[model samples]
Structure formats: structure tokens, C-alpha cells
Target: MSQFDRQSFSLTGKVALITGGASGLGQNYAVALSLYGADVFVVSRTQKGWAETRQRVEENGQRIGFLEQDITAPDCAAAIVQHVIDHFGHLDILVNNAGMQLRNDVLDYQDADWRRVIDLNLNALYYLSHEAAMVMAAQGHGKIINIGSMQSYRAGKNIFPYTASKHAVWGLTKAYADALAPDNIQVNGIAPGYISTDMTRSLQEDPVRGPEIKAHIPSGDWGVPEQLMGPVVFLASQAADYVTGVMLPVDGGYLLR
Candidate 1:
């Protein structure tokens, strides 16, 4: 028998909850966990476009479920967490991947816009985490994976709110990790860099900025949603029980520049 203990990375009996999982990185994360043997439940603002996620998970022989809710709405945290428990029997992992980037120059940035980004990216994420932590604490083990951004480290122009929220995400990872250590609850984050998603399609199509962004990354190309699969699975599995408070980058070495 192999001594690698590959089972440590398997989530065969786990149940994971992902936010904004109907599309983008969240969608891929949900699918990744399912493929790795975890039943997944997704929460999104809409029910549209969920067919692919459902089909993919079922095809992989894993169960999949979802809920339509705005994460920022009052009392949503407890409701979603309860929904996961009701459907999956228990929640082993929670992925806070629902976020938005409303870009505008400093002088042109609206107060409303700033609040909008923070509500979904930071405030909502924290509340959901709070609820999830309680369940995990009671169970004596769990994982919370927050999705941060390159802005978590280097603040780029035109996305001030997004940058600030991401920085706070890293801090929350450390804070929650420290507090939840006694309960065996691991809280961590993944910071993606220059991923090629619909949101970034415009940037990729830009003649000047496209090449400029690629030059800054050591990997020499934009990353994809699938690139984050392994890192997320590792963090959510038994393999990372001893690991917490880290923001692992799925970036193509974008921070090296």
C-alpha cells in the first residue's frame, strides 16, 4: 500500500457551502469540491445558470444543492447555514467567494458604490463566516475558505473599495484562525491574480493593458477559474487541518513582479 496518505486530501464524507457559485470562480470551486467527493451547496443571488453546476456535480457522482439569496440581506447568514445543514446533514466547509468590483476613480467613486462592494465582499462574508464558525465549533472541526484578490496585497488603481475589502479578508483569516484554533476550525484564504473571467475579458482584450498584465506575471498568461481547483480542495480537506491563517495565491506568480 502507498504511504502517501492520499486519503488526507479526500473530502469523501464532507459537505461544502459555496457562495456566488453559479458562475466564475465560485462555480468552479463548487465543481472542484464535488469532483473530490464532497456534496456541495451553492448560494447565489439568482437561480439562473445553475444547470451546468448541477449537471457537473451529479455527473461526478456527488450531490449538489443551491439557494437563491442575497448574502447581504438581514438574517441571511443563519438561514443559509441552516439550509446547508438541513440539506446536507452537516457543513464541513464554507467558501466565501461572492464579491463584486465596482470600479471608479477616487474623485468619481460614489459612496453607494463603496458600500455595495463592502456589503457583499466583506460584511456579508464575515456574517456568513460567523454563522459557519458556530456550526463548525459545535462539530469540533471545519474549514472556512475566503476568496481574496491580488488587491489583498498590492492595491491597484480604480478599485479602492475592492482593495480595502480584500485586505480585510486576509486580516479576518488570521483573526478567525487564531480564535477558532481551539475548536479545530481552520480559516484561510485564496488570493487569485489576473484570472481570465468574463469580468476581466475587457482587460484581456485591451491591446496595451493585456500584454502589460501578462508581463507582470511570471507565468506569462492570465489564470483561469480551473487553476484554483487544487488549492481550494487542499485547503478544504483533512490535509490542511494544521494549516490556517494563510492566503495561498493561485495567481500565476503575479506577486513576484
Candidate 2:
């Protein structure tokens, strides 16, 4: 703690596996990790939109790998961890970023629709983390980063399941961090608020809600992917070896206002 070690923040020679990594914030996470010297592997439901992911990583002089499979698929937890180990010889980081949100009236929401959100957002994360934890436990070190949201702390108008799932995400992050601390694995989360992405286009473009959102944030604007790059790299590197069970908010002071 007395001396600064920039190398501790480097992810050189690490292997990272990211779920839903083909596009959006997930893609950004992959790119950022790779730029920090990790060989990134992406997993998602389809092979579409991977060209850009490959171009970005390779352009930065880092190798990239891909696997096409629904993260919610049965046994995906074990398969994905094994797939990464097989491809890179060992796994050092796992990013649980695959998730969905549905804006529906809670009173009229169907059970199937609710399950769809929970299955993908919460259950898949749990499964993947469990498998990755075991793999990391054996290796004596690893990093697991979960993507939570401002909703992980507060509920929205119609995203009932997303709110529930993200709150659970925060809980699971703590639980896993405590459970895996003995194995030298740090489990943490990033709770983003009003990030400018395709997923939040509707909300951002909403004439009525958009301004209200911008006005509410202390920064007075939506956050960009690049804004999250530093925290992501820090959490995944040796710099965060003693940091765990914590939810780091990347919000533009939205929670404060």
C-alpha cells in the first residue's frame, strides 16, 4: 500500500470469458479487458455481430474467441467454464453480463414473461458463477464481475422483474464474494446508471423521460462505455485483490440526485 505498482493493474496473460459479449456494453467490457492484456472470449446466444468484436480485439493485438450458445441453456455453466479453459489453458476472469429487461404492467405481466427475465438475468449468472468459482478455487485466484444496475438499488416504473433480478444480483455478488474469498477469488459488481446504449435507446430517446433523466443526474448527461473502462479493468486485475463483495456504481451521480 505504501508504494504504487502500476503492473498490479495490468491484466497481462489473463483469460477472460464474457457472457452476452457480442454487442453493447458487453462488447465494451470485452474490448476493455483485452486492451488491458487479457485474452477475451465471448459467449452469447448467436454468432451474429461478432465481426466487430473480433476486429476490435485483434486490432488491439489481443486474441479473441467466441462460443454460440444461450447462457440460459441447461449445463451452460459447466460448459462455458470448460470451453474457456480448453481454449486458453486456464480461466482468470468471468463477466456475467447477459441479461434482459421487460417493461410491462406488473398486474398484467404473464408468468412466462417474468420467468424469461429471471431465467436469463439471475439464474444464468448464478450457474455460471458457481462453475467459474469452482474452476477459480482450484487455480487459487480469479475475478468475477457482475453487471448490476441502478435498479439494483431502486425500482423503475414497469421493469418489475429487472428490478428484482438486479437486487438479487447485488445479493449474489456479496454471497459469492464471501464464499470465494477463501479461494482468493474476488466477486464484485458494476451498477451502471443511465448508460447510453442501444438497450436504453428507448428510454434515452423518450421525449418526456429523457430530459427528466438527464436533469436528475448530477452530471446532467448519460454515461458512455468508455467511462466504465477503468473500473472494469481495475476490478479484473490484481489491483482489486482485496476488494470483494462490493457493488461499484458507475452512475453519474444519478443515485445522489
Candidate 3:
């Protein structure tokens, strides 16, 4: 095959499972993967949002399914992995993208809130990825993409838990990659910086803070969800088969400035 044909980023025969895929970045990852030819399974707690995501995926003429899962539950990881295998026959890509952010000063933060944030953002990912890695190990080749954040590197006021979770995510990515690379299962992360999602719309609309944030981004604009498509597709494709444990930042150079 020619280089172009051999290295095409098409996911024609792949089955992808994206956690928290009912909306936002997870939804974007689902759509982008389906558009690139992968059958997608989305896991989320909201049936309403999952239905919407399913509709969009179906409109693209790709197979799409969903598992209503409360990722915070202890058994949620095993159940989700089982659901994907039962429905899709095999799993080739796993995207751990579900997370939550709570903004409270370290001194004022509630213990419950901190536990909730860490449970969802860090613990759940660990459990889910552990289950998925077993499936990937059996298959001998698979991709595990963790969704990290700019907070992985810098501190943000009133968001201690989020920062801590992201930092842990980075470490998890490296550790998983080291353990799994020998088996040909690649683990990596994508750290998105200030993307313009509904979650961040309030920040964008804030007259006092919006412009200040934009000014720091060398791109002079917030990144759109679609801008993340390429990076995600690349990470999930054969092109990145030899790449693992690296955190690719899709932050529009916000990290630099």
C-alpha cells in the first residue's frame, strides 16, 4: 500500500467506547470517531443526553449505542466494559472523558465536594481503564485516551480538587502506557485548555474575566469543540500506534502565554 493508503487515519473496523459521551467533549469525541468510520458506544448517566448523542451519530450513518451508567458507582467500570463487549463484539478505543469541576477555595471546600470530584474525575477513570485494559490486553492492540486538562500543569484559584485530579490523570497516563506498551496497548492523554463548551460558556460570557482569559491565549480566541476533532482522531488512529504516555495539549497555545 502507498504511504497515504497505509497510514490513513480511518477507523473503519474499530469499536470505540467513550465515557461521559452524552455531551460536551465526550460528544465531540463520539461524533468525530463515528465520522472517521468507527462504531461508537457512549456511556453516561443521562438518558436524554445519550439519546441526543445517539441521534447525531445515527445521522452520520454510523453504528451508535449507549449504556446508561453512573460512572461514580464502584461497579460501573466493569458493567460498562461488559456492555460494550456484549453490544459491539470488541473494543478498540477507550476514551476516559468524564469529569466534574467544583470551584471552591481550599479553605472553604467541603469534604463531600472534594470526594465527589475525585471520585468522578480520578477514581472512576482508574477503575474504568483497568477494566478496559484487560479487554485491550486480550485483543493485543487498543488505544486508551484519557482526557486531561490545563489544570494538570497550573493552579487555578478555588479549584483544588480539579487540579489534583488532572495532575493524577497525567501520572496515570504515563503509568498505564509503561505497563501496557509492552502488550501493544497504547495509553495517552489529551489536555484541553479553555475550550468553548457549554460548561465554559459562563466563563466566556463573564465581562470581567472573559477578555482577560482571551488575552492570555496567543490564539486570541477560545478553542471550539470541532478543533479537538483532529487531535482526537489522530490519537485514536494507527498513526499514533507507536506513540504513548504523552499528553497532547489542544489549548491553542494558552499554556505558552
Best by lDDT: 1
In candidate 3, which residue pairs get closer than 3 Å at backbone N, Cα or C atoms, i.e. clash? none
Clash count for candidate 2 is 0
Off by more than 4 A, model 1? 1-4
lDDT of 2 by residue, 164-256 (tens): 999999999999999999999999999988899877899899999999999999988999988988899999998888899999999999999
Question: Across residues 156-241, which tens digit of lDDT does each residue of candidate 1 receive?
Answer: 78999999999999999999999999999999999998999898999999999999999999988999888999999999988888
What is the total number of backbone clashes in candidate 3?
Answer: 0
Q: TM-score of the candidate numbered 1?
A: 0.97
Q: Which ten residues in a row have the lowest lDDT in candidate 3?
A: 1-10
- Local distance difference test, candidate 3: 0.90
Count the clashes in each prediction.
Answer: 0, 0, 0
Off by over 4 Å in 2: 1-3
After superposition, the stretches of candidate 3 with alpha carbons farther than 4 Å from their true spots are 1-7
RMSD of each: 1.7, 1.3, 1.5
lDDT of all predictions? 0.92, 0.92, 0.90
